[model samples]
Target: MSLLPLSLACWNYDRTEALANGSVRPEGIDLNFQALEVEETFFRMLRHHEFDAAELSMSSYCVTLARDNPPFVAIPVFPSRLFRHSCIFVSAQSGIERPEDLVGKRIGVPEYQMTAPVWIRGILQDEYGVDPASVTYFTGGEEQPGREEKLKLDLPEKFRLEPISPDKTLSRMLADGEIDALHTARTPSTFYSEPDAVRRLFPDFVPVEKDYYTRTGIFPIMHVVALRREVYEANRWIARSLFKAFCEAQRRLYDELLITASLKTMLPWQIAAVEETVALLGEDWWPYGFSRNRAAIDTFLRYHHEQGLSSRRLQPEELFAEETFESFLI
Candidate 1:
């Protein structure tokens, strides 16, 4: 039988490397995996429908669902999961010492609809009583000029979002004290070049992030594998096939991490790090299925709606292809 040809664009993540390198082919599919940066993949896929499938921003996917005839349908296969406490940078001279101090301040974001800032805004509101509507958000490129939101956002009147001048980058604005803080996925160049000018809101972020996880079991999913809706409508079984392949790839990675005789990765303490993570989070620390991640998904959906991104609160079950929610028993 001839396999169906399918193209996918995503970053070269360790968990998905097997799929990219052709070691783990999805059942009945000839995968053309293009390894690209997250931003490029998102832009090409979101703007042009460049691939059959791609790693999509979680918040962006939810936003699309609000529109008639949403472009993509996702599997629960998450390529990136992060605790975003370390992503918040505040101007040292702005006198924003605590999360509460962010209220009424001008904050720069690469895009107001980006997944990282959605999670950050949600966390601040839930954990520290910082309302999402209180701060005025300045949106634009983080490092370069002429960046814009990929999707048009019809946010509520309470939220204040403005675009920085075409020539101005958020990193420079934050460093120059033009914006009081920045919530972003990538660390701004200014954070390293002008350390005194920009500092992490949570200087000791590891402990704070760990505590946030303990209190709320959300590791915060950033990106999900999305199939173009037309492709998914034609071959629904591909969802399960791809989901199984991704899970198998991740399982191989987990097994590789447990080999203590010689370090499989560059880190000298990879074993210790894995052990600590397992102790903090259970054996299935990075889960992929719907049931396993329902709470986290629900939390993010609520955040999307509360922050005026999603038109209505979407159920977690509505986010993925129906075939991905379960499997046949052996």
Candidate 2:
């Protein structure tokens, strides 16, 4: 019998490594893992039938695909708090010290309408009374989805947006001194390229705004892994097996990459984040699956719509594979 050829699109090498090492072996499967930079890029390929399955973020962009595009099932994995964090930085020499100071200033980002930028702007408007409209934005040259063209759907129209070319991406501009501020939700991300940028802004610059966002019911940003609904529904075992493998990998990767015995000195939240991740995983062999996180996804999507981030709300099942929803019950 010919084995199933399944493609997984994810961010880091760990997912690829896990599958190759036989840690996440699915039934009737010959898996090929493709590491990608952006979830949107992965989804674009998914629409063209490039891969049998995929993992994408549950952002408005991804969810919109599940609704309007083909029959892809999206399973929500990981808490937004655990998955990602948004960062906004100014040149140390710019003297734009706080959120309020962002007014009339040019801000650079990869996506203008993404959750991270929206929340950042929302905070600026509500807490500091800054005008979000006045802040000129540069979206780091994202290509419009080809699916939009095929569907004859006006996806970008639902958003107040304009596109910038890849050459004008935020990182390149930050390096060229063309923009004054850089903001994003990715860690070990583009912003880290400017080593001395933070010290120039404040002799002592620490990430403070994220805590404020978390306290305000806006969870910290996180990236997710999405799948097609049909692939998931037809091959339910593959979803469960993949989730189990990821759970195992998350623990192994965390212990190896993040936790350091020598860094004995750390903040309380830093320690808490690590501890929480470990506690949640426990002795389980699979920590990476969405079967356990339905309520969290539901609550999160509701907030996205309520805050006007996504135009419509999605059911938890719509966000994940229905076959595996019962796994959370166990």
Candidate 3:
């Protein structure tokens, strides 16, 4: 039997690297996986539907669910989970000390509806009482000159979202104090090239994130695996098989990270980092499927809705293929 050939686009992270390399594949599929940066993959998938399936931004994905006919359907497999507290950078002169200080401030975002801004804004409102509506937002390309949301946002009335001029970029605005702070998944060019130029809102972001997790039990989810709706409808079985394959690939990658004989991946502290994470959180800290990630999923949906990105509040179960809700046991 010939296998179905499908193109997939996603970040080449440890969890998805094996699948991308063809070391692990779905049972009935031949995947042509492209290893690209998250922004590039997202741009291709959301803009052109370039691949049969790929990692998609949760905020953008939710925006499509309310459409008359959404072009994609997702499995419960989340390709990326990141804490967004560290994603914020503040101009040193802003005098912004904490999350609450962001009120009435001007903040630049790569895109207003991007997943990182969603997570950061949600956390800010829930934890520190900083309403997103209170802050003025400038949205545009993170480094380049012009970029727009793949899916249009239906933001609430009175929510101020300004478009940065094509001549200016978020990094330039942040560096020149045109914006008091910037919220983004990627660090601003100045933040990297000149450390002191901009500092993280929370210098001790790790501990603050740990505390936030301890209180809410929510590790923010960034991206999820989505299948094209036409392809998904024609091949429903791929949903289950691909979900299993992704899980297997992640397990294999995690095991590789624990290899102590020598460095298998990343740095010398690779093993220690895993141990510390397990000690701080749990062994299955990064989880797939709704069962284990209920809180995280529900929280994200709530944020997406409250942030005005979603037309209506979406239940976590509604965001995924129905068949993926309950897996089989043998």
Instruction: Kindly report which residue pairs in candidate 1 clash with one another.
Output: none
Candidates in order, TM-scores: namely: 0.98, 0.65, 0.96
* lDDT (Cα, tens digit) per residue for candidate 1, span 1-330: 999999999999999989989999999999999999999999998899999999999999998998899999999999999999999999987899999999999999999999999999999999999999999999999999999999999999999999999999999999999999999999999999999999999999999999999988889999999999999999988999999999999999998898988888899999999999999998879999898899999999999999999988999989999888875312
Can you give the lDDT of residue 4 in candidate 3?
92
Expressed as tens digits, the lDDT of each residue in 1-330 for candidate 3 is 999998888888889888988899998899898888888888888888889999999888888788889988999888888898898899877888888889999999978888989999998899889998899999888789888767777778868999999888888778777899998988888887767768899888899989888888888889999999999999988888888889999899778878898788768698889999988788887888878887898988888888888867788888888777765512
| Models ranked on lDDT | 1, 3, 2
What is the C-alpha local distance difference test score of each model? 0.94, 0.53, 0.86
Off by over 4 Å in 1: 327-330
Pairs clashing within candidate 3: none
How far in Å is the alpha carbon of 245 misplaced in model 1? Answer: 0.2
- Which has the better lDDT: candidate 2, or candidate 3? 3
Off by over 4 Å in 3: 327-330
| All models, RMSD in angstroms | 1.0, 6.3, 1.4
